[model samples]
Target: MTAKPPPDPAAPPRSPWPGSAATAPARPPEVTARRLVARSRIFRVEAMDLIFSNGAQRTFERILGGRDSVMVVPVLGAETLLLIREYAAGTDDYQLGFPKGIVDPGEDILTAAGRELREEVGYAARRLCDLQRVTLAPGYIQHGTRLVLAQDLYPSPAPGDEPEPLEVVPWPLTDLDGLLARPDFTEARSIAALFLARRYLQQAHQAPAADGKGRSAPGNASSPSPDETR
Candidate 1:
């Protein structure tokens, strides 16, 4: 008839600590502090390094330093994606990834994106989406890599004065699963870029019907919806 004392208040109000709410102890301070003792570069490869910071050693790869740059994912046709393989002397392995390079001191990321697209794939994009900005490696590197999604492309003249022997390869979309599953698809920046690009492309291709025939305004158009299928 007394409602069983309201079932002892249903587990009691949480005191944010393991003590009686009426006399609970104060909570500990949140973790919001860190110190950078020092940082030194022990080894420097092109755009990368083996760095030691605050007694912690890590690989610092500068996809883009304080400067601006771009990474272009070129989707050719509906079934193939264009990629580049450049012989990386440091690792002595062919690094296959979206075309990416430094921003040449004063250029913006978007401009550099277009330039890298042309240089690596001999193509230009009529429309490119800014997918996201991400750090190459936050624990060590002081730089970030910008991921861009490119489409509506056309062949441009070869970057007449090529600097490196870049092999432009057309990989079938169906093979993307295999490429990612391979043991060597392991570079941080490239991995991040490919995943972001793949996610964006998949969503774009499978996008639901729009209410109208005309394409949505540029900013209003979908910008790489997260991988719902996954």
Candidate 2:
């Protein structure tokens, strides 16, 4: 089961994602030199010189990034998933995906998620669950994005730096197949977040409910979550 019996708060979670029979291979090549080749308003490109274990030398260019990002799966109620249709400069077109942004220098992922949700979707979540961490262009880039599952939404809007108002689309979670079928919904991070969040929610909803004294009981009925009182 994805959700194991609840453990001590001091103890970390144990139910890691299932693993494959094939273990990870040997360590990567050693970097010999790294030099910044280019810099733009938002990105920095670096040239890297590396020598493989077999003593083969190769040079490669990679985007240099340091800030961690948060992409939130904002669920309105139990079945609706909130997405934003924003103009993507990289593609020069409107793309559909979850509300996301870079974490500020001093901000935590949860805080950044709340800010992005309010700015992009006009909602704030009372419960923010950290589903997993994902990477972008691992072969060429060094940045990680946090996948967050946002629930218990409430109406709250904040100002954003977008040049245009983003279109908010609440799609039924059941039509995830349809969402994936669309040509515009093509962000890898967003797609991964959707699948991960679905698995997490399904596991959580089906897991045994905990009693008043923190004892788990076998049942389909869910106890009052934080959102229930709101």
Candidate 3:
């Protein structure tokens, strides 16, 4: 067989996942001007005039002024995850997803995550790991939500602003496919958080022990012993 052509150094880096090879510009576009376009009780829309490095100019409208939020994936024990079903005002239907809420002024992200967990699912996590920060739509939305993985959960209900009590659903962590197949679990942020949490748990399970033993780290609830797996 003929030798494959040399890779292009200027080409965008390839992603492990298919059809995801693209890179951001070396320099971001300059914002020439911005103006408030609309305002509602809960949302403000702003228009931005930008000039790209390539001399292309465009005006984009983005939602602004919302506080950054936190989404918590609460792992109960080693296998179960706690989810909540609540009425979604935008969709006009009840949806199932991880507990999430806006971070209050002067509140920490992890603290906000724990509070949302307690408010929505009646549980608090002793251990919380920040998984990632994700945006809804970078092209039009300036909103972001921090994904957090929570473990070592205990009951700790708190009053919340929900019009009705949320329904807590217990799901097996091993049955992530089953959860994904459900119609009600359609929130994109929640879906992304699920995979992020899973990847983190897997990495933690395979990490070397601190004592120099050839064993994995201990006390990770998500990791089952070899015997337990068998």
Candidate 4:
């Protein structure tokens, strides 16, 4: 008898790639039942009873997610990157990062990206390109983040729920080393989006087909909108 091989990480996924395939393990554990263990204003903890294919059983805890979120990488100019300095309760300090917000119900990811750009960065993008979707702390968090590249921006502002106004910081993409050296630019999601966006822009710039039409880059395709499930 021959044993079946595990799924190949190098192989393309059946659906769009959401996270790093390198992190995926073969034969995912099936969740038998989920029971609410605790609830707070912002978080709901669920106790998950899971059974692996090999007959192993374990209990895991995860936070119940409400809605998807979008992180906007707005291009201020040929070399400029717009970031925001906002207060992070988890860190108990301010962090510098991109314009990001939750995707409200009934709105698609692209629209939500544009909305967040206006609300957080005081600008609305004429062309919004999709970069990728990222999951932060996927082992416990049920939510995912959609990264977007915003270009051809025009001044537009909207009211936001932030207790204090966010300080918009414009950094040059060429100075990534300097930005990374800063103590405040430490958000994992933001860091990933920045690098991905930079790579996409570089590819798009190299591609003759891009032609500054605001389309997505060649290989970095956008995932399905928030209205669709993976």
Kindly indicate the candidate among 1 and 3 with the higher TM-score.
3
What is the TM-score (0 to 1) of candidate 1?
0.63
Q: Mind giving the per-residue lDDT tens digits that candidate 4 earns over 82-194?
A: 99999999999999999898999999998999999999989988778777789988999999999998988899999888898899999999999999999999999999988
Q: Give the per-residue lDDT of model 2 (tens digit) for 1-230.
A: 02234334676545545783233224457788989999999899999898765678999999988898999999999889999999998999999999999999999888999999999999998888777788988989889999888898999999999999999999999998999999999999999999988877776666555655432532112333323322
> Candidate 2: which pairs clash?
none
- Which digits, one per residue and each the tens of the lDDT, describe model 1 over residues 1-230? 11122233457666556553554323322223333444456422222223222234343333224554577777776667788887776788887777887776777767778888887788988777777777765655566667777777899845634566688878887786887876655677777777777766666555555556533433122533343223
Per-residue lDDT tens digits for candidate 3, residues 48-163, read: 99887578999999999568899999999987989999999999999999999999999988899989999999998888777778999988989899988889999899999999
Better of 1 and 2 by lDDT: 2
| Candidate 2 global TM-score | 0.81
Error of 2 at 49 (Å): 1.0
Report the candidate with higher lDDT, 1 versus 3: 3
Worst 10 residues of 4 by lDDT: 221-230
Query: For each candidate, what is the lDDT?
Result: 0.64, 0.83, 0.84, 0.83
Error of 3 at 163 (Å): 0.2
